[model samples]
Target: MAEGAFIRDVASFEGREVEIRGWVYNSRSSGRIHFLILRDGTGFMQAVAVQGQLPDRAFQAAGFAPQEAAVVARGLVRADRRAPGGYELELRDLEVLQGSPGYPLTLKEHGVEFLMDHRHLWIRSPRQHALLRVRAELIAACRDFLDSDGFTLVDAPILTPAAAEGTTTLFEIRYFDRSAYLTQSGQLYNEAAAMAFGKVYCYGPTFRAEKSKTRRHLIEFWMIEPEMAYCDLEQCLEVEERMVSAVVARVVERRRPELAVLGRDVSKLEKIRPPFPRISYDEAVEMLQRAGHSIKWGDDFGAPDESYISQQFDLPVFVLRYPAACKAFYMQPDPARPEVVLGADLLAPEGYGEIIGGGQRIHDLELLQARIREHGLNEANYGWYLDLRRYGSVPHSGFGLGIERTLAWMAGLEHIREAIPFPRLLHRIYP
Candidate 1:
């Protein structure tokens, strides 16, 4: 290894010899010139190997290096307008550590199932790389928004005594002799944290055991739940719009290349500013019915339903005030309309579907207790949760923005599975 230069730091070594360790992503050559494309995870760069200029060992290694083979390129960095990442490696020497034989993935079209089955290897592709980068930026931007806004980070348990959303879609676990379940949402714990810290958020993995095969559903996924004490429904919506806009701005500014790689229309993201359009559930239902759907008053929105409503707006639209019976047990019912809860679901534009669901929480102990019992959940299990209302309850509000769903919408990806590095679906879980 010469001079120990990483591909990302090659600009500093311009006109000077340096070493690059990476895997061969691609290769092409005429009889006289060989172009070797390499990626070191941080970035991709091209290394040129010409005939008669290299020693037999170096020339032979570069000429026949298979895709995915491990190699080290000793070269001088040079600026290239046409090369990837705006730089090229002039190979003076080449070393192949290990050769990959008959790599399965080639430059051909593969079905989604086949690609997903080979996802462990398919991540090497440019689109997959871009998706991963956008996902990272989304997470970073979310944490930045919350942390800079004076929101404390609180860790939520993966295992819980009772489900946050409901028990129907919970994955129950046998904990020694007692029964526990994987957390469906971090909302409840974020609530308790908000009461203690004034404002708090939880960013972690959440599980949903529903047997959904929709493009937007994932059995295991990540969520960013921001809960604020003394915040009303309107303030919560403001926080949501701000957080989402910031995250989208980060992706658009820092990840333009990644977005281009995914073929995302930058204009759509450029329109993602604050003061997003808001409509009521009644309006959404009317819109859905007008769109030729037979949706009733109390029914929730489905994928097609959300798609129709979202297509009406260019920015992420918030549909507020769902029927109390259709919402979670802890959602606060609107004082003016006892039948509808003061909740909201942010549906992304262009049929990306609902990426956020949240609302003001019920702070009254008796009301929460009645809701719990009405929902047929065990009261004894919610004693600790009830204690929050009993001890010092404030009108707190929060919302969870699904990381993968949001990433899919931001990157203009077709499937939500591509948003995460290693996706866990209802039936598929492997390498």
Candidate 2:
């Protein structure tokens, strides 16, 4: 009947009696002594029940409770170096609210498919819990960095009348009596907002219809896009490196325990600072050729190419000025070399490619209209977009940072699927 306490805060209440309401993570018994590992969402704690320390029924309940059984445990919090989270509870009473006998998941290893099938329950596992916690920390860090850097949060529409990236990767959906598609990126809308607010960002889910089974692709993912009104490519890159460094520093400082749970190499993350190495498209292609890749000048970098390029640097590397032919139509062409656009992709180190893609946008109405027509896109659908340039378009720059890919790289996850909760992939969309 003591005041309820979460395991995460039990350290401050050492020696005080409190009731922990949660599910039994694991249980074991050795004669009269019962050990119950309880997880109350915030953290895990080992609750010990001695036969004579409490009523017979309470001790029996502690011993017999199955894994994941809902329960309330009244106990005195104690410090124990060997226990999980460095805290233990001496149980005075135990009440099993629901017996979860024969839980579907066990201590044994399950196949990826089987685990994916049970992802709803699998997230309760410690590893999944840690990954999700780190993800939350990363998201918060990104928002904090952006907000503190004079960026206003402006929301963009999920249903769009046209594609922001390309038409091929759009997920078309029928609106009432017409057609609409899920948004690929919020960069366009963010540009409009930047004109109004000077500096703005839109954070939301984006959908892509790529049928990729690679470790980096997701059907639905979150993007953090920031646009600045009078920024150029160089200024954009400067903002990007600073924001990335700040976010990485925050995760390293506050999410150390979670990162440790994921077995992340914090040393590399600690080295993520400003002034990341920048290479021109020509330079990157030369490096690839020297490394024996068969890619040509205008070809976009694949996962392998990006990985190879990123691995050459200690910090995230910026590959700048991609060929205008392969980049988005809105990218501003370089004045000295009109063949390339003033855009860049920030490739994460250790083979996590292209976490952030952005660049200076075309502010000339005539050029933008020409580029749209050249790309075989309908100018009618983009009249409003061109109007931004028609009115008073200043030099603007922005980028979209894919949350899943960044988290996967930071957490050292093997697949992007684990970076998100309820991942919607090309083939799987179940619970």
Candidate 3:
């Protein structure tokens, strides 16, 4: 048996015979020459098989193997600018491990629902492969930036007794004799972790039971929430800008090939630097009103409003100091303007909205208690959370960056569903 190699590393094996084990991406035949495209998850490469060089059976296998057929091919690698990944293989032998003829997905156009129903198989396509690879790179970039910036990773519980964002979007479940809900946000727990470790982060899947079906909304999504003790809203904004810029830079540097595969405009991503444009909620509302939107000052922004605001700037824009009544109860109210809270929502450019949402949290025990009462939350369930304030609460700030939304923005995906491998949307829960 020849030495085995992955399609991604085939460039290093030029002129050397190696065995590639993967699924057949595509195949075509022209007279005596058969071209086979193979994908091994790492990347895609083309293998050319000549009828006279290989045995008749092997040539037939190469020519007849259908899409996604499991196959092992031995070939000598060569540089070919015309081929995928700028490399191709001169096939010496081909063996079909398992024939996958009559595959449901083909080169023909497919409806979104049909494609989604066959998502288990749809991910095998080159475009989906590129999306997944970019998603992985973005996730790694996020963790690397946080880990290097003195932020400790702390795990938050997936199941909790109370709502963190709001009671309206809680997924209730039975916890033995009592009831529990899937966590909407880990911010409340991260607050406690920040108090202990000074700077901490929690990265995991969070659930929101929203009923509306929008291209930007996912019922289950991943989030990276970072909390910093003794950090105010301004400091938090600084960290947000730096982290966002760093993550985008890393993706641009390392995942260029994947981004190219997705047809993303790298020049747009290259412009994501520090000191993003910041405007207050009042200014945003004024701009929206001037632009003929029917939004008022105290009302929260909808998808259309956010899209309009984001489109006004080239970089991610921060809309700060939203009305306290529209934001979460934990947000610290601005001292000078009691009606608005010291919170910020970082909206992504080109119509992707609110990738990051966070701000300085209320640290005073009395004020927190009052907010809890005002929100009509059960105080008994939050006694442990209240203990953090009673012990040693300091002014702190943090934010949650939705991984799917951020990846969608970075990858230039039209729907947020493609950012995740197996998306859980309002009505989607299959393969």
Candidate 4:
């Protein structure tokens, strides 16, 4: 028995016998020869078996093997220009480890609903596999950029006593007879950590009980929130753009084949370097009106409005300084314009919508208390948050970037659901 090798590394064993253990992705048998396609999560390869060369049982196993059937094949690895990984297996012996008959999915096109229902199986498909590969790369790029920049990771709690955004969109739960809510964002806790570590970030899953069933929305998602002490709105924008550029470049470089599998234009991603176009909220409103969108100042722009604005740029666009009423209470009020906050939303191009949202946080104790009361939130729940501003708060800024949304944009996916492995939508939560 030859030592086993993955299909990806099978080329190294050329002209030598090796064992490959994987599930049969597909198989086709003629009268004298059979071709077996094998997938082991790493990659796929082809195995060939000739009737006269292998035992009768080996030929029988190869001829009638079912899709997803676990199998092991001892074969001589050979170079094949026509194979998936530029290598093929010449089977000398074969054994069916577990015959998986009647697999649910096929190599044909399936409806979105049907595929989503079988998401676990659907992920094995080429497109899903590629999409998720890029997603993993983007996450690594994010951590790489932040860690290399001297930011300490400070994890945020999932169960929080207070809402980071608002109560209306919170998922309420009972924790030992007391009401608690799933965290909407980790920006607030990152603020405290920033004071301790000077630069900090929180990367974890966050919950939003929003009833929105839009393609761009998810019930539960992962966000990366980075906070920096002595950072202002402009500086936050620079940091955000740099991070976005780094992640995009990484996905483009490492996941080029994956991007191509998803039909994404590499040129669009290559133009995603830093120095993305910037426009004030007022300017965005004006641009929207000129573009025939029925939006006005002080009103938050909807998907249609955002799509129109983002389409004006080749890369991500920064829309900054939104009206205070439309933003979270923790955002710092603009020193020059008290009615607006030093906030920003980074809208991805190609109509993918907002992928990041953040701003300078309020650092004055009195202002923080007033904003909390103004927003009609309970004061007792925010005592710890307010204490940060009371003791010694510097002008700090941060933002929350949704992992799924960013993945969708990078992979050119039609919906955010495909970006995450097991997505939680407003109406579906199983599997």
- Each model's TM-score? 0.97, 0.98, 0.98, 0.98
Candidate 1 ranges beyond 4 A from true positions = 81-86
lDDT of 2 by residue, 1-431 (tens): 58889888998899899999999999888989989999999988899999999899999888889999999999899898877778899999999999768998997999999999999999999999999999999999999999999999999999999888664589889999999999999888898899989999999999989898888999999999999999999999999999999999999999999899899999999999988999998999999999999999999998899999998988999999999988889999999999999999999999888999999999999999899999988888887788889778999999989999999999998999999999999999998
Angstrom error of the Cα, residue 303, model 3: value is 1.2
User: Candidate 3 residues 7-68, lDDT tens each?
Assistant: 87887888899999998988889969999889888888899999888888999888889888
Ten residues in a row with the worst lDDT in model 3? 161-170
| Model 3 segments more than 4 A misplaced | none
Instruction: Give per-residue CA lDDT, model 1, range 407-426, as digits (tens).
Output: 98998877888988889998
- Candidate 1, pairs of clashing residues: none
**What local lDDT does model 2 show for residue 229?**
95
What TM-score does prediction 2 earn? 0.98
Candidate 3 clashing pairs?
none
Candidate 4 structure quality by residue, lDDT tens digits, 188-251: 8898899999999999999988899999999999999999999999999999999999999988
Every candidate's lDDT: 0.90, 0.92, 0.92, 0.90
